[model samples]
Target chain A: MHEMSLCENILQTLQQQANAQQYSKVKTIWLEIGELAGVEADALRFSFDSVMQDSIADQARLEIIDIAGQAYCSHCAKNVPIQQRYDACPECGHFPLQIVAGDQMRIKQLEVE
Target chain B: MCGICGCGEGHTHSHEEDHSHDSLDHDHHNPIDGHQHAAQHTHAQGLSPARMVQIEQDILAKNNAYADENRRYLSQRGILALNLVSSPGSGKTSLLTETIKRLKEELSIAVIEGDQQTTRDAERIRATGVPALQINTGKGCHLDAHRVGHAFEHLALSDHSLLFIENVGNLVCPSAFDLGEAHKVVILSVTEGEDKPIKYPDMFHAADLMILNKTDLLPYLDFNSAECIAYAKRVNPKIKVLSLSAKTGEGMDNWLKWLKAELELQRIDYA
Candidate 1:
């Protein structure tokens, strides 16, 4: 799964932060994954432990923050919560909503030693 | 703002920005005792005093760095790079071979074929008398910008050339990794279900152009062309669609024209 590669990216970020923050080990990581980011949290969790093996963040707890999907409705001219990319506007029922937010995959913060 | 790490709320960084060790000053906070010996140190509730470090960085930052580098390199040389993505048996290799055969004489063309383990695609492209590099991902599902950048070096692409990066035969993972291409051209064969757009929304949404390949087989299949287009439009309103068959060269002119338009656009921007 691509979640393996995503976890590798997370591990790299953790290593960089560990060096910058002068921490020998990481306790927990808070990853902000949006609902529309196309990343499966379960897949990421499954690959996290193996990907973090022998790294500075070995055995670090991965706490994912699920961000809600949001889109800008052109018809309604309002921001609406959407579950899928092709979701219509909740109010106007218009198709092809412009995505304004909730498609980000970012490392928010880390709980480290 | 803090005298320790220079990381504040307003701090913004590019993908290529090097984040060196900031060397946090632990001298004031018990030095070795603060940095180490944290496993044994517990708070009032027996909770580890784990410090929270704010790092609002994109997870794709590393891959984006390589992608940015590739974009610059290609743009500087006026190379029109397109990433071709599709599922297995979508005739991505056949499309490239056919395209190269048609365009290699008029324009400098090269290809980078990606697969889990196969040089066959690259060999096929090379058989068309165009330079092709095979990137065997070796269990990797997608080609990252880093690997593409490395492949670019070996390709020795000419100025104002066309580079096609035929990604691994998977619709899901390749949509996420940006290989520094000018555009991502996703090819969907008619033999596949017409509801593929909705089934793989991420790929369709990320794609700039969707090529409905193998249109020659439409007569025998139940694939609804209009419905497929409609589904694709639902996810990406701005996505351009073109139906073509790499085998019989049906609607190849339109595909070639699209390539020419992109090349011309790249030249204009370079100018």
Candidate 2:
């Protein structure tokens, strides 16, 4: 829902990193967004275009890497993949599992020159 | 106009006066035009193509850094800061005003009210005779850590005091932004659906305590208390639940007790 602000943050990061990284324009940006991050990939992509337009990453490509939500269920005794935080364990039907992974929004890499 | 794309928006650079990306064939050398924008893209030295740069940085790292600063500031001073989050019309301000009225004399209380475009919440808070700062987020949906830090600078909060950060009335967006609060207290009113916990699981999961407000209206509505608590547990097993009505003050005492306990704990920790 706040994808626009998120895109602006991405642009700011790109610009700040440009000085040290020795790059003028960003060619592609790869983001790892988890299902539990409360971010929609399509919404982020849509916001990326406007936020990046006319900037150093103008016309840049945004590649989102989807990270599946994983949580450890004591009943299952293992990590299980679920879509939402409130989802019940697929194997044991127990919910509110201990979250082990996902819920991350990070800039993994950038193709710059 | 951008010489590369002809987009008449950005500031025109001297080197890019007539430079076109299509005509670039190692034009680093002067081509009668001394204004060369070759520095726009730094030379790759040995690499011939675009190189991959590993960042592995959190997108919210800047905000998180600011939040960490706020956390350090509050924790060092033994200030108990609570971030109050809920949907619009969920009685967050009302509950805060009510809580302030009860605890203002006993506790050194301050408030930071956040809204998209109003000082209304802050006004309500100040009427309780406690120092309150209003942060109008403008187009922003949530109160960011940086903004909160600025507001904190202006508010004269005493040591061992309680700072209540009434965040923008948004459940989904505010769930992600941490405002350096000791805990996130989500106020869920019975007027809203009991299925809210499941629908907005991120907020329920992130929150440490869930306050079921407007219990006074529970008798007239079909809101099921048990089902709401169950759903909240389904999302967050460790989430503490408290049911109360800010209007009638039916269970406000419990909420007050919880706040006092947290404040005392912080004082102990600070000592």
Candidate 3:
């Protein structure tokens, strides 16, 4: 799964941040995973646990905040919550709506000590 | 006012006190050993709570950087790169074989076949007398930008060349990463329902062209060509849709024409 690779990147970023700040332990990690980011939250948590073993974040708590997918409906002239990219607006049946938000995947904050 | 630390006139002293209280609270709650607690306190002061917000860095930044580099590399070599995405057993190898057969005489073609394991697809492409390299992702669900970069090293791309990267049989994860291709062509066989574009819209949204493969088998299946096209068009209005049967060679002329047009477009850009 791509989650494992993403976990590896997370670990690398964590290691770099910890080294830069001279922190020996990371207590909690707040991650923002968007609904439309195509990444599974459970799978990412599972992989994070497996990949962070013996690393600085071994006992770290992962707090994942799921962002709802939002889209700008061209025909409706309003923002709509989109479950899938091609989903038509509930208010107006419009194809090819532009995505406004909810494709984000980022580490929001780290509680390190 | 220091932007990095967020320490203004009235906030500096209180911020230090609040920082100390936070570390003290952490020590009271977790109760780590003396040495570790001391080490943590030193670093804890530097942790501004403002770092929590406005860190608008994209998570896919690393992959996008690699993809940008790949685009530059491909541009320098004057190669028109296409990333082919589809479900497993969707006649990708067959399509590649037929495409290579048609274009190898007039165009320089190279292939990078991605699979979980095996060189079978590469072997099939090589049979057409074109150079093909196999990238076994080794249990990976999809190919990333870095892997494609590595594959480019072994490919001998010349001026006015075509390079096809057959991504691992996946419709989801592959859409999230850009491989620096001029076009992303997604194939859906007739056997796979017409509603696939609606079900997996990310792939359809990312795709520049959609090919309804295995059209020869349509009589045996319950697929309605019009419905499939409608679904794809609904998802991505700009997607060019083509129906073809790699087995019976039906509707291949359209595919060939699209390829030739892409090559000509690349030539025009180079000119």
Candidate number achieving the greatest lDDT relative to the actual structure: 1
Q: Give the per-residue Cα lDDT of candidate 3 at B23.
A: 11
Candidate 3 colliding pairs = none
Give per-residue CA lDDT, model 1, range B66-125, as digits (tens).
788789889988999999999999999998888888898899998888888857888888
Give the CA lDDT, 0 to 100, for residue B126 in model 1: 84
C-alpha lDDT of candidate 3 relative to the true structure: 0.77
Interface RMSD of each: 6.1, 6.6, 6.6
DockQ of each model vs. true complex: 0.45, 0.48, 0.25
What docking class should model 3 receive? acceptable
Report the poorest 10 consecutive residues by lDDT, candidate 3 chain B.
Answer: B22-31
Q: A32-70 in candidate 3: lDDT tens per residue?
A: 888888788889988989877777778788899989988
Kindly indicate the candidate among 2 and 3 with the higher TM-score: 2
Best-fitting candidate, scored by DockQ? 2
Q: Please give the lDDT score for candidate 2.
A: 0.82
Q: Please give the RMSD to the true structure for each candidate, in Å.
A: 9.5, 10.9, 13.2
Name the fnat for model 2: 0.69
DockQ leaderboard ranking: 2, 1, 3
Model 1: fnat (fraction of native contacts): 0.74
> Total clashes, candidate 2?
0
Residue B159's C-alpha lDDT in candidate 2? 96
